[model samples]
Target: MKHLNSQSFLEDSLKRKVIFLTGKGGVGKTAVAWATALTLSRNKRKVRLISWSPFESFSEPTTLKSLGITWHQLEAAACFKEYALKTLKFEKFFDAVFENRVLKAFIEVAPGLSETVIAGKVWDLFDRGEQDTLVVDLPATGHALSFFKSPMGIEKMFATGFVHRQAGNICDMFVDPYTRVDIVTLPEEMPLVESGQFVEHLMGLGKFHLGFLWLNQCTPDLKVPDKIPSTLDKSIRECLEDHRFRLEREAKNLVEAKKMPLVVKKIPKFSSEAVKETIEQIAAHMEEK
Candidate 1:
């Protein structure tokens, strides 16, 4: 319910060891995640940005290293392999078991194993104290909800074992006050609706510490004089009217977003900037605020 400026919001969010940034697709969640990591690193915090991808290929942006933020791309298979090695305690045994063709295939097709392992790896990082902060760029709303819920499902399914224990630990982190989730979305109809629904869904789960909602790529409101220049062409006048309408729509969506449970922060539209520059600009905006 608080109207927080960017700096204060970032400070408060950093209190949580793990911050998950997620919302509908194409809402600039990854950009916000990178910005947050950069901002935290600039404050001298040891920060790590983790991006979840379902594919085999992974790459870290060189800009992250320049900002002093460690970056990791998490894939389910790799995470599962690491988790198995740690839990099984014998590299040889793990490789023999997980490397088998049929077993590997079965494990891959296992209902919630991948999701469980990914979530567990994140908790492992949080528990290991390897970094001051872990910023996760999660998938879209539906997949993210499933990712966070995987721990509980695994805990119930396993009942008693290392997997159960791991799931339980991750679930504990979920309910911890210091673990927060930030939902990011654009100031438009579909994203706003999904964000509101996502907030309600997280609340219904009764676990996560919903941190805030970010309204990204918001059009700035520009003032127009009552008396317009008569020399202006008709196309220019129409373009100005259209721009004003978009701004008004963005404002209305923002109002609706504020009605949700968490604080809402707006990121002005930066359409022309490259990825790295956009991240830096967002970080600067947070610093200034």
Candidate 2:
């Protein structure tokens, strides 16, 4: 119901301990997450940026260290290992149990075990209070939603045990007011449609707050004269016409975005630059808002 500019959005985000950024694939969710982390870091917050994926492995972004934000790439195997080590309190015991082929095979066969372990790792980060902020560049929409909901699935699947407790803890963190989910989307029909459905799904989960809807790469409004000069070249006029059509389409998408209840922020299309520079530019714009 309320609208927020970049500045207010950043300010509001600073109040949350954890922020999960997600959207359709190739919608620039990672870039927005990096910019949000950098903005918080620049404001003197102790921030950590986490890249989370279920199937694929990831390397930490090199730019994170330069921006003074701690970085971690979350993988199921690594998280499971760390959780096992901590709980068992002995590396030898963990290795013996986990390294056993039968147990390992059973774990691999478990439907949501891997996802639960990864969620536990994220929960541990939040529970430990090691950092002021955690920014999660989550996987795309379907996987991301399942990732967040893994805790609940685990709870139902396991009546009581360490896994169940871990699930409960992660679910608690997820439903807490301090944890926010930010959805990033393009100013296009399919993305907006998916975003709206995702928001409703999150709401259905109950108490999982939808923080912001980021409309990235929005076409900037062009100030053009009502009457085209007869002296203008034909090719130039055609280009102008194309630009006008794009602007019109963007306007319709924006109207649809504004109709949603969540706070919306438009990130302008930036010029091609190095990844670090682009993140910096986005951060600057966030501050300006």
Q: Which candidate has the highest lDDT of all?
A: 2
User: For each candidate, what TM-score against the reference?
Assistant: 0.91, 0.92
**lDDT of the candidates, in the order given:** 0.80, 0.82
Angstrom error of the Cα, residue 15, model 2: value is 1.3
* Each prediction's RMSD to truth: 2.4, 2.3
Residue-pair clashes per prediction, in order, are 0, 1
Candidate 2 lDDT, 192-236, residue by residue in tens? 999999878877776777778889987777665677677899998
TM-score quality measure for candidate 1: 0.91
lDDT of 1 at 215: 88
- Scanning candidate 2 in windows of ten residues, the lowest lDDT window is 1-10
